[model samples]
Target chain A: MKRSNRLIVLTQFFLENPHTHTQLPYFVDLCGTTKSSISEDLDIIHDVFEQQGLGMLHRTTGAGGGVRYIPKNADAYDESFILELCEKLKDPERILPGGYLYMSDLLGDPKTVREIGRIFASRFSEIELDAIVTVATKGIPLAYAVASFLQVPVVIARRDPKVTEGSSVSINYVSGSSRRIQTMVLPKRSLKEGSNVCIIDDFMKAGGTITGITNLLAEFDAEVKAIGVFAEADDEDEERKVTNYTSLIKISEVDTKGNQMEIVPGNFK
Target chain B: MKRSNRLIVLTQFFLENPHTHTQLPYFVDLCGTTKSSISEDLDIIHDVFEQQGLGMLHRTTGAGGGVRYIPKNADAYDESFILELCEKLKDPERILPGGYLYMSDLLGDPKTVREIGRIFASRFSEIELDAIVTVATKGIPLAYAVASFLQVPVVIARRDPKVTEGSSVSINYVSGSSRRIQTMVLPKRSLKEGSNVCIIDDFMKAGGTITGITNLLAEFDAEVKAIGVFAEADDEDEERKVTNYTSLIKISEVDTKGNQMEIVPGNFK
Candidate 1:
């Protein structure tokens, strides 16, 4: 294969399998290139990645040293992305009875979800996460997307536990919207003790659901390292159950009577 | 940048944006390489892709011609993947009441979901799907995964319409497992009328949920191009509501009383 072709294949391999370490000799054999030549290629690839602000390619020195790619923070379109998202959230038709905006459209689109996941993954990349946790239903897709880019597995907390999942750990919490006691369950074997988890969800009204997940994680000695939501409601009357959390978009106001809404960017930083 | 580094960047760009067209001049400006050199690089990349069965690159002729990449069917580890998955499903503990298997763990893993998505995308690439459809909860992740690779949006059919989703269309279908009448709903504007959709799910018994989605699509005058699932029960007692569906693994038998189960490969080919 030509040197350029080898570069192309190597680039795809690394990007597809992020956070994986590969020995230099493995690339040497795959590219059929000399050690020195492979080293040079690595240098060029790393430089381009840095210049483009795509991500970082790290080289570990000493024995067992290898190359690993850590995705760069997705800040290139951070401002515009959030602006466009806020615009979408401002649609009056989306407002429901209890001050909620219909976000299924944004959550379902792959392109939209990819950007949201990238932003969340970028923000939380520094924290070592054992798994991305979310409640079942709408949040599953968002959790899966974030987990995919982070190269981690997703752990779903079910509102109703199924018999097929075997023995499970259950918790009771108050639903923010309904203000009713709700049961959340997770299989006992789904997560390991002492592992750090990142809680994610589609929306945050009173933030009751997120608190429930955090409390549930406590049973297994797991800690909630971070919490992320696609959107969060801003209501002066009702205080948020979970205080420390990040959201991509904030709903400042939702007027179902007049069919008007206000939205703004969240604390992505 | 050197031509080799340019090749690496270009490869990443193309792979990231699959099934999209780009003019040769875009590479010429980006890489600062001559048209002939860029063409030669493309040839090399195309050859390597074909040799590895990664995908294909096609060049349209005439005035508005450009190059496009179409991912080939993911066949690198088809046999092993199914064999390993079958092995996992055969675990007796996975069997639940009424002969269902606990597959939430496999379904939640991003890596596992990606492979499954690739297989489905590979099989349905030729169909030209506008959107991937599924019922709420478990199927959302699988649908999102497939839609991401296929570069389309996901349309989730909710079992119960949320007030937040605005107006919706509801349908009645029998639950294959419980043999009870159930309601499924989808937002009125969630999917475009007459759009071709691929129905995906995590599991299928009598395939009632998929049939429900199919019925819902018909209300909008849309067509069901294909249906794919990760697992399906092979019970002879109950007749399948939907025929001509694709599954990755088949559950031959689930002897919950005996604490045993049998699994086999599905119709990948």
Candidate 2:
């Protein structure tokens, strides 16, 4: 194959399978090119990938070494994206009864969710994760999105256990706001013992749900490597259950009567 | 930039934004190259994409015309991939107490779900879809996967209502097996009127849930352009409710005592 054609094929492989190491001989057979020529192509691709801020095409030598794509986002782009998200949250039309904000539309958008996943993945890029764990329904999309870039499987915790998941480990936790006891279940077969995981959620209030998830994962001996939240409600007066976590956006105030809300960046460091 | 570097960047662009168009002038400025050079690079990428069964880079001329990537699947590859999936589905260990198949592992896999989404996207590639709809729980991941390839938004219907979604339109439907009335909710603002949608589900057993989705979409005056199911039960005598649907795998039998399963390819032309 010509270098141009190989470039197209190589780029597709990297984008589709991030964080997976494929040896040089595989590409040699795939592109029908010499090792030296392939190396030159990879060098050019790596430089362009870095310059474009897409990620890094990490390469290593030796018997068990090869190349892998580590996805990353530029700091400048992430700043602008988070700011725009805060601005969207400030929309008065989003204010609903009982001070809740309507955000299903943004979460429903594939492009927007993909960008959110990219930002979260970039933040947790330094950590080694065996799986992306999240609760059912809303958090599932965000989990899959981050898992795509991290190249790991997603383990979902459901509020109710299903017959299709076989035996499960269930945990009960109290709701922060409602002060109601709720059950969270994880199928025993879904996760392995002592696995490293990152917990993702769409929103956080008193962190009761996240705290519940952390307790549930402990049943299987899985480590909660990191916690990433899309939005965190700002309530400094109320004590929070989970103290160590990262949030992208902070919703300072939700004024239902005024039909307006105050939004700001989260404490992400 | 050199042709090699341009190839890298253009390939990344096409992969990330499928089903969208970009004019030649945009590429000219992006690659820092002449229009002729960019055209040559596109020709190379287009040919490779088609040959590799990655889809097409459709080209058009004139002021409003540009190039778009239309994703498609080759029959030979699709057949082999689906067959392999069936073989995996036939694992005796997947048998639960009541003939339920343990499929959470497969659904939780990002790569596997991605390929499943690609197949569904290819099946409905001809249809112009504004959104992909699916009920909450297991179906959310599949819906997002298909929406990613189709470059459309995902609208999810839930069994329970949440305050953050604002006001919603709820519908009652009979469960296919249990014959119990269940409520399905879709937020009013989640979808627009006269929108074309594709309904995707993780599994279909009498299609009652899908029928409910269709009825709900009717409330918003949306059109059900296509329906895709990951797996369908081979209970021919049961008499399914919804017709005119595509399935990738047909689970013929699940013998709990025998600890074995019979699986085959689904009804896809």
Candidate 3:
């Protein structure tokens, strides 16, 4: 392949396979180029990535050494997208019964969800995590998106266990918003023992679910390295169930009768 | 910026935002280059993409014209990954009680799910889709992955409706394997009326779920443009409930007593 052709192909490869270490010979074979040429190409790619605030490239030397790409925040569109998202969240039209916000459209948006994942991944990038853990349904997309950037597997906890998943570990906890007891199940083999992981969810009320997951991971001797949520409801007067977590958006003072709500960027800093 | 630096950044842009059309001015601004320079850069990128059998670049030469990147099949790793997946599927350890295959590890791996999504996207790329619809839990990742590549939103159906989603359209359908009547729900506003969409699922036994989604879409007058599944079980003696669909792998003659299962590539053609 010509240099121009090789550059584009190699760019896509690194972006798709982030945090993966591959020997130089592999790129050389894929790009139909030499060691020196591939080395120069890597420098250029790394430089542009750094310049754009995209992320940093880590290179190791010796027989086992290789290059790995780690994606960071979306500097290009992060602020603008968050501002736009808050505006959407403030739409009282999104207010559903039981004081819940109807933000499924936002969650369903691929680009929006992907960017949210990137932002969350950026927040927890410094931590070494073995996997991204989340509950089933809504959290599944966000977990997969973060895992995509971190190049890690996503282990989902479901309300109902599947017979196809073999044996599992199940726990019961209070649903913060509804104050109802709920069960969360994880396949026994889905997570490794003593693994370090990050917990992610689409929405948070009193943080009961987060605590539940923390307890569930404890059964496997796993550690929760970090926690992230897309949005948090602050209308509750009682103390939060879980602390020391990150949220992208904060929603408060929801008025269903008047069709209005308050939405702002959360404490991501 | 120089052509080399511009090339790598632009490469990431198109890959991340597939199928999004942008006019010349956007690139000129993004790359900090002149219009002609941007045009030439696009050409080099487009040429290299076509040469690598990646996907065609659609360009228009008018006031409204812009370049759009559409990703096709993963010619590089499609066959090898599927073969490797088949080997993984054939492992006797994966056969669970009641002849279910324990493939959560495969579905949980981001790369595996992303590739499966790409393969499905390649098959349905020619069709214009308003969204990718899937039932909740297992299918969420695959649906989001396909939507990521297709530049479309994903609308997920739930077995249990959440009040947060507002009112919904619910339908009763028979579970293909369990032979029990069940309900699937889609929020009233989640999907627009008269849409064209593709249905994606992780596994199919009797195809009842796919048909349920089809019926649910019917409530909104939405068309099921295409259907794709990662695997299908053929051991059932009865005829399949649905037939107009594509599958990546076939599971047949699963012998739980013998602790073995037969798995092969499915009918992508």
What lDDT does model 3 reach? Answer: 0.87
Model 2, range A67-142, lDDT digits (tens) per residue? 9988898888888888998888778888888788888889988888988888888889889999999998799999
CAPRI-wise, candidate 2 is high
Report each candidate's C-alpha RMSD, comma-separated, in the order given: 2.2, 1.5, 1.8
Residue lDDT tens for model 3, B144-220 = 99999898899999998888898999999998888899999999989989999999998898898998999999999
lDDT (tens digit, per residue) of candidate 1 on B1-269 = 56677777777777776767788888888888888887877787788778777777788767777788777754756768889988887777777666667888888788789878878887888897788999978888888878877888899898788877878999999889878999999899799999999999988989888888899899988899999998887878888888888899887764536366778888776
Fnat of candidates, each listed: 0.86, 0.93, 0.93
TM-score of each: 0.94, 0.97, 0.96
Q: Against the true structure, candidate 1 has what lDDT?
A: 0.82
TM-score of model 1 vs. true structure: 0.94
True contacts kept of 1: 0.86
Tell me the tens digit of each residue's lDDT in model 3 across A51-112: 88788778999988889988886654666778899998777677777667888998999898
**Whose DockQ is higher: candidate 1's or candidate 3's?**
3
- State in Å the error of residue A35, model 3: 2.7
Instruction: Locate the minimum summed-lDDT window of 10 residues in model 1 chain B.
Output: B252-261
State the lDDT at A96 in candidate 1.
70
lDDT (Cα, tens digit) per residue for candidate 1, span A1-269: 56677777778877777767788898888888887888877888888877776677889977888898777754756778889888877777777766657788788888788778777887887888999999988788888878877888899899887776778899999999889999999898789999899999988989889989999999989989999998887877898778888898877764545356789988776
The candidate scoring highest on lDDT is 2
A91 Cα displacement, candidate 2 (Å): 1.6
